[model samples]
Target: MDVSKIHGFNFPCPIRFGAGASKELTDYLKANKLSRPLLVTDGTVAELSFFKEIKNDLQQKGFSVEVFSEMHKNPIKSDVLKGGDAFHETGRDCIIGIGGGVALDVARAIVLRVNHKRDLFDYDDLIGGDKYVTEDVPHFVTIPTTAGTGSEVGRSAIISEDESKKKRILFSPKLMARMVFADPLLTMELPPFITAATGMDALTHNMEAYLAKNFHPMCDGIALEGIALIANSLETATHRPDVESRAKMLLASLMGAVAFQKGLGVVHSLAHPLSSLLDTHHGLANAVNLPYGMQFNYEGFEARFDKMADAFGLSKNNGNRVVDHLFEMNDRLGLPTKLSAIGVEAKHIEELSELAEADFCHPNNPKPVTRADFKNLYEKAL
Candidate 1:
């Protein structure tokens, strides 16, 4: 793999991927005749040197840029609304997402909110809101700075109700980015903990997608390969960063996002509650709950677990070994091995279980997950 060069892919979306892919950003915008762009990102990324450089490049090329960086780690409806207001007030013609998941999600939601102005949550794809997404969205592009969430290539935004903190999905094919610059060089400066948490998030996406009860064999194959890539590179990316490791992780993360179009399962259901109820980082929540969720899913589906074990290069037919690897991976990545370490108390279990039971991801689990099962998993992980 020539990690030094750029490559283009048209699967799931149009992506310019590799070490220097971000250099093409201005050219793409020029070709589309978009002179003014609203740059949406999180606060931390907005301060980073690489992000500043990207912003600088656009300005040097004489493009008018308006930046909106006020957003939470878990984005809410107001974030999208605020960004939409920025676009309208600044007279921007396009939107460019330039951070991790939170930034990308808000940007996509802003794209949806810009032209189709009903109540923001009224466009929630959960309640048949996508049918109302008939208007043309502003040209949107993304340049991912993290290998987690893979929202750079995704067509949906997971925004929450600010007061209730209940997640709502704002989805549409029109929400897809016109182009993605997936430059691994942008991820090279990630702190170790961020790398570990995001890498584990990628792993969880692949694992749950593969085990989802959906019948898409193409997604199944892509999920297994995504599992293999993360298995080979995640620890290295987290502990000792390099372009090769970051490249593999970025590719695997994108693959996970694409594959999970088949569906996700119990792990996401377990993770979402932690993010909403406890305000934990989404990646870290997924990391902590991953092994426990896999353990719960392993019993009735030993053969499926064996397939994942094969991806991890474990000895054949031993489903428990697959679960063991997940636990071991968390430890090596310097992530917490239990819920208690992340501030989840016994008092929080019932509410968390309720949230998990109501989450949208678990119905696709190969085995049905009851509220009782969620409660037990929380207890065991705690």
Candidate 2:
């Protein structure tokens, strides 16, 4: 790796690794001097046996712990407000964000608004105001149950706005979790399709970050390794359902999240609006848009894609092989291959294209995207 090619980058995060690492959560909190904590997670994850063990451990450690599980799949401003109010009412000094991205994002927003002003939209990066984040945001820890989204290590939270009908990004380094616990055991029971979709989502993150116009070798290296790991383990993890595969998948997801701190591209930009308009699962939406984005960026990323092929053990000219592989992987994993297959229609393309072009992530893509480009991509995906 030529270190000279990359410059001006900052990476910050503490990571706890391996299986059964989640058992050390209370010790981590105590080491950081947090005694009162709120466990922020979704209802489905809260019902998992993993959360049961976590709840028992926190209580046994003599910490005052409260649960807040009202966050939605695509969290909204109202959801953040509710979560912040819950944190204030509980008088928690720390937050334990568990489950998937939605829960972690909610936890970040809750901490952001804990003792601050009430207007959640004021804090959104798209709203043209100063960031609401402060160093006083609660001590936070994250444990992700799903092997996608990578919110455990991410510094940004995505939420939907009812009025705008689009997803908004809220970013702050202060919102980063103090500790990120990657425990593969918690992901063992995930359904095959969910595993596949989330794995593809992680792959998309790595691809987009690598293709983004950013000067960060560390993030680039991380993205390459993340892509390789997903290539090596996604299929096995989806079909075998073993601890080792699960562990690799979880690590890959975290790596993807860490890498994308550089930026994302058209896939995520296009997927976000499609998800909002069609009620598509976030990961699945990314999966459907992956190939289209790859084709769009093909000319610009030929050399990079070839390098990625080398890293993933593909032939020299097989630069775009991942696209075909992703389609096959989606079919094997029982996910939708096309937008139309998933119920997205031509009628929504005009609106979806305009919103996708307006997306913040669109500018970071390796290839410049115009409204016509977005419309074509949407039509191609369908």
C-alpha lDDT of all candidate models, in order: 0.93, 0.83
Model 1 spans > 4 angstroms off: none
Query: Model 2, stretches more than 4 Å misplaced?
Result: 1-11, 127-132
Which 10 consecutive residues of model 2 have the lowest summed lDDT?
1-10
After TM-score superposition, the amount by which residue 46's alpha carbon in candidate 2 deviates from its true location, in angstroms, is: 1.3
Could you tell me the TM-score of candidate 2? 0.93
Supply the global lDDT for candidate 1.
0.93
TM-score of each: 0.99, 0.93
lDDT for residue 333 in candidate 1, whole number 0-100: 91
Lowest summed lDDT over 10 consecutive residues: which window, candidate 1? 315-324
lDDT per residue for candidate 2 within 60-163, as digits (tens), equals 88988899999677888888888888888878888889988889988887878786684676767777533555547778888999999999888778888866
| Pairs in steric clash, model 1 | none
